[model samples]
Target: MSPNLFFQIKILANITELRSLIIVKQLLNSTFLYIGTFS
Candidate 1:
């Protein structure tokens, strides 16, 4: 494979990782908020 193609794959992978991190953070925040409200 070409170097350019490898770079593109790396960029996409990084973006996906970042997106998942953001999603997980949001879920954790919501969970804490819910628990706070209940308690």
Candidate 2:
């Protein structure tokens, strides 16, 4: 495979990882807020 293709794939993988991390962080924050308010 070409170097460009490898780099592109890596970039895409990083983006997907970052997206998931953001989603998980947001979920955790929301859960904490819910617990704080309701508990």
TM per candidate comes to 0.98, 0.94
Q: Which stretches of candidate 2 lie over 4 Å from their true place?
A: none
Q: Which regions of candidate 1 are displaced past 4 Å?
A: none
lDDT of 2 by residue, 1-36 (tens): 999999999999999999999999999999999999
Q: What is the C-alpha lDDT of each candidate?
A: 1.00, 1.00
Cα lDDT over the full model 2? 1.00
Cα RMSD for predicted model 1: 0.3
Task: Write model 1 residue lDDT over 1-39, tens digit each, in one string.
Answer: 999999999999999999999999999999999999999
